[model samples]
Target: MPVKATREQRVGWHAAHKAACGCRDIPASLRPDVIKLLRSRRKP
Candidate 1:
């Protein structure tokens, strides 16, 4: 089985993802849909 990620790893991943996407603060209009899309694609 795969190991679970630690809190620090999660935080680092979010930071890196935001930096790479250049969307640290997604706008209000797109926030909901964007988050939904992201969650839908999240790997288990």
Candidate 2:
């Protein structure tokens, strides 16, 4: 991850990491936003 990643970048990296490696989860701070993003993408 970048040393000074933006909120979106941080969330995206964590999301991808969560998918590729089930070792860790996105931080609590970012979890809600990540879920919101995922839900939005699933919409028609």
Candidate 3:
């Protein structure tokens, strides 16, 4: 991640990292946004 990454960028990188590595979880600070993103993807 960059020194000044935006929230969306951080979230995206974390999501991808989780899928590709599975070595760590998303940080607590970004959980809500991660949930929101997951929910939105499930919608039509």
Best by TM-score: 2
| Model 1 agreement with the true structure over 1-44: per-residue lDDT tens digits | 11696644544455446547855675565556556656766799
Query: What RMSD value applies to candidate 3?
Result: 2.5
Runs of candidate 1 exceeding 4 Å displacement: 1-23
Encode model 2's per-residue lDDT on 1-44: one tens digit a residue.
89999999988887777656859877999999877776665647
| Candidates' C-alpha lDDT | 0.57, 0.80, 0.78
Using lDDT as the measure, name the better of candidate 1 and candidate 3. 3
Residue-by-residue lDDT tens digits, candidate 3, 1-44: 89999999988777767656869878999978876776665647
List the candidates' TM-scores in order: 0.46, 0.71, 0.66
Winner on TM-score between 1 and 2 is 2
Instruction: Please state the error at residue 33 of candidate 1 in Å.
Output: 0.2
- The lDDT of model 3 is 0.78
| Per-structure clash totals for the candidates | 0, 0, 0
Error of 1 at 14 (Å): 13
Show the colliding residue pairs in model 3. Answer: none
Candidate 2 vs. true structure, TM-score: 0.71
What is the overall TM-score of model 3 with all chains considered together? 0.66
Give the Cα-based TM-score of candidate 1 against the true structure: 0.46
Q: Which candidate achieves the best lDDT against the true structure?
A: 2
